[model samples]
Target: MSRRLEFSPTVRQKIIERDQGCFFCRRLYHMEHALPGDLAPKDIMHVVARSHLGLGVEQNGVLGCRYHHSLLDNGNKGLHREMDSMLQDYMRELYPGWTPDSVTYHKWL
Candidate 1:
């Protein structure tokens, strides 16, 4: 049995809709690019990494704008690493009980 690694469109759309914009803008108070007309989220980030066996459900996903998503994907190369690390703490808050074992599983399960 294989584990699903990517978020389905349905789940992705729901996340974008629920967030109503960048999750950081709405929740984390990051309004750097959130102007008066910004409403479309550019990416849905996994709280747990897909490579690390993260699932694609809403509880495990979040909406982010392009700039924020780039920061999330940037791994320890810049001072922005602190910014991304902060996001990890936020993810923990978002999914309080999430663990590798809880979020990862075979499709059959």
Candidate 2:
């Protein structure tokens, strides 16, 4: 297996500022409830995973509150089997030019 990492500090901050909160939460809940986006870099997930050559950068990052983040990663183990697929679609809409190999292994830390 190869090494993978979360977003770097600077990129993480940029992501936090850009996202402002969990876009996933907003998308899922539709702002019905108050969701805290008080997340750290650890909460940032790669839209395209590093195993597939995703870089740890804002362009490939998405913030999520703990519950939603875990659900996205784990797919709620059958609760939502297509969370990752949904996220991929959303991220692609967000980044039209971001390809898995575009910045592969170039600026990870």
Clashes of each: 0, 0
User: 6-70, model 1: which lDDT tens digit per residue?
Assistant: 78899988887876767665555444644554435378887666766778877677787766666
Task: Give lDDT per model, in order.
Answer: 0.66, 0.65
For candidate 2, write residues 1-109 as lDDT tens digits. Answer: 2434467789888878877777666565433433445333237877776666777767778776766666556663563446666666666787896565664665543
**Model 1: CA > 4 A from native:** 1-3, 27-41, 77-96, 106-109
Looking at model 1, residue 15 earns an lDDT score of 82
Q: List the residue pairs that clash in candidate 2.
A: none
Among residues 3 or more apart in sequence or in different chains, the pairs in candidate 1 whose N, CA or C atoms overlap within 3 Å are: none
RMSD of 2: 4.9
Candidate number with greatest lDDT: 1
Off by over 4 Å in 2: 1-4, 29-42, 51-53, 79-81, 103-109
Q: What's the CA error at residue 99 for candidate 2, in Å? A: 2.6
Cα TM-score of candidate 1: 0.62
Compute the lDDT for candidate 2: 0.65
